[model samples]
Target: MAEQDWDSQTVIRKRGNVARVARTDSEINSARRAGVSIETQRKVTGNKADPGVHYQRIAKVDYADDVVPPPKLNNSVPQAIQSARQAKQMTQKELAQKINEKPTVIGEYETGKAIPNPKILGKLERALGVKLRGKDIGKPLFAKKDGK
Candidate 1:
């Protein structure tokens, strides 16, 4: 084999794992000790404390006073729901069953205690055949012409 010219040298790249970077024995020992301590702490105290240490646990702090309150359902909504349900000769439980919702959910809406949910309102409208929301509360969802 002829020696290659310096100007035309073919380079071969090395593959596989490179040598680990040098670390002091004390540093390596400390890392191992820290790992073992963490494992032991987890076993002893469980994982609950680790989240608070490694990540911000927002739930642990009281933010209720800082947070804005949820909007309450209007009094008109309760009246509309109650009247419509009664017009159909349906009890709260029967209305809830018809809508595939819990009786408490229907009761809450009827009492205007639940937070307004459009999906629930839509379900109620379809089931009770009335409009529980918008400008025409307690009106038929789909008004029919007297002739049609």
Candidate 2:
């Protein structure tokens, strides 16, 4: 294969698309070890002028009052599961392989009406590399009690 010019090549980083030229798997691992999520503003090449270079994550998320609950979103649990899976770069087959299950199980998992068990949750956490509990996603933030 012919060598591509470094300047012309747009090296897309995996996991989170942070810009880095000719990044290896080691670099990606190192970056992850350094906690390079979308949370803190970290420079890739130390170019302050570049918005794409110094991107930051939002800490506090706002919950809109008008927002509908999860049951209203897509088909429910599976949709959230599906979205989170995609965000973590996991295909159903890949996730299934990690959980030591067949690909068909994963398909059922993403579309079935059955509530996910702890074993399945464990697989999901490992596969997506994120927590599945709490304000995980796709659920509305409920109003607090007034303590009347």
Best by TM-score: 1
Model 1 off-target regions past 4 Å? 1-65, 146-148
| Model 2, span 57-147: residue lDDT tens | 3212223445674332225557767877787688888888888988877787678544557687666656665555455544432435789
Cα deviation at 30, candidate 2, in Å, is 98
How many pairs in model 2 have backbone atoms within 3 A of each other, for residues 3 or more apart or on separate chains, i.e. clashes?
0
- Model 1 quality (TM-score): 0.55
TM-score of 2: 0.36
- Give the whole-model CA lDDT for all candidates, comma-separated: 0.79, 0.62
Give the local distance difference test score of model 1: 0.79
lDDT of 1 by residue, 34-103 (tens): 6632122232232574544533344435465478889888778899889988988999889999889999
- For model 1, the run of ten residues with the poorest summed lDDT: 37-46
